[model samples]
Target: MDKEVIGPGACVLRGFVDDPAEMVRAIADIAASAPFRHLSTPSGAPMRIAMTNCGRVGWVNVRSGYGYAEVDPLTGHSWPSMPAIFTRLATHAAAEAGFADYTPDVCLINRYTVGSSLHMHKDRNGFLKDMPVVSVSLGLPATFRFGGQGNGEPPRSIPLVNGDVVVWGGPSRMNYHGVLPLEAGVHPLTGNTRFNLTFRAGVVKPAPRLGSKTG
Candidate 1:
């Protein structure tokens, strides 16, 4: 796989997964256990993309707000365990991007169809802010908009195809990123859809407040 650096602490590993079919099968299993659903934003607006999770904790957005929960609100059960293939790929990809010893406890699976798009936002809920976010792309291609720390900053568009992996942390941890509206397309594995697996260290204890004492 060819590693292309996109920023100070971000990179794209082109064709990282040689056998995406294996990963696609695993994702099917995960979805069977935790079916994808559109999570509502704080404003009560339903997000365009459908999402699910597999790990110790899953990212959730409810009327209360966005945060990680140990159980799925929809099913009242723990999210499906993270599959070995998902964990292995995320760990190796993070290491390849310079973030070593990365073992993600949460894998957020996003399903995008034509017209589905994600708004630019920073990943700030995870307490392990030092760890990198390893994102793997599968199926139809999409344009990734990566921006600076500021909310109003214009973003640079990057095209990502199947098997592409993007990892970012350190200096670029809080940078804003999102996916543009997916266009019509069809792939052998996923048909007319796209899947994204975002691995994150979601089980860490919350960091102490600025003035809080720690041993």
Candidate 2:
């Protein structure tokens, strides 16, 4: 993955996916197992885009609050593990961004339509401060808002195309970021919806075993 420094502690790697078709197909199959659903914020506000999870820890929100859980609340089962392809991509992207040996345990799959957009926010999953968030964009085009910590200054609008990967870590790990409303367009592969897979390394907490007897 050839890296292009976009900002201080931010980088973009182009054409990271050798076979975008295979990646798309893999995602579709994974989604069939774990369907996408729009998640609600802790404030009870519904998110714009529908999302799914394919990893050890799936990000979820409910009346309780926002955080990562080992089990999928919708299914009462553990979220799907990250595919080998996704792991490879995550490692390569992180390396390009100067983050060595990154193995993300959480994979957040987000789906977006023409009018779908994400509000600017930082990821606070309680991981190492230097672990980068590797985001892979496929399907439709959208403008990504990249800003400094806090909401003081205006963010730079970065155009993301299909097969592009963005990695943020180090001083920029907590930087605020989000996506603009997706533009109406059809990709030969994804057809209509835009697919974004964000890879994040989350702390692992052992879950209780089923049918275990306690003294």
Candidate 2 per-residue lDDT over residues 1-215, each given as its tens digit: 56777677788887777777878887888778777877776555677798888887777763345566677767778788788999998998888788898898888899899899999888875466778899999888889889888758678998888899999998888999999989889999888889999998856452332211100
lDDT of each: 0.86, 0.80
Give model 2's TM-score versus the native structure. 0.90
Q: List the residue pairs that clash in candidate 2.
A: none
RMSD score of candidate 1 (Å):
6.0
Per-residue lDDT of model 1, residues 9-112, tens digit only: 99999999978999999988988888888887666667888989998888776334677777777777889999898999999999999988899989999999
Off by over 4 Å in 1: 151-153, 205-215
Alpha carbon deviation, residue 138, candidate 1 (Å): 0.3
Report the Cα lDDT for candidate 1: 0.86
TM-score of 1: 0.92
lDDT of 2: 0.80
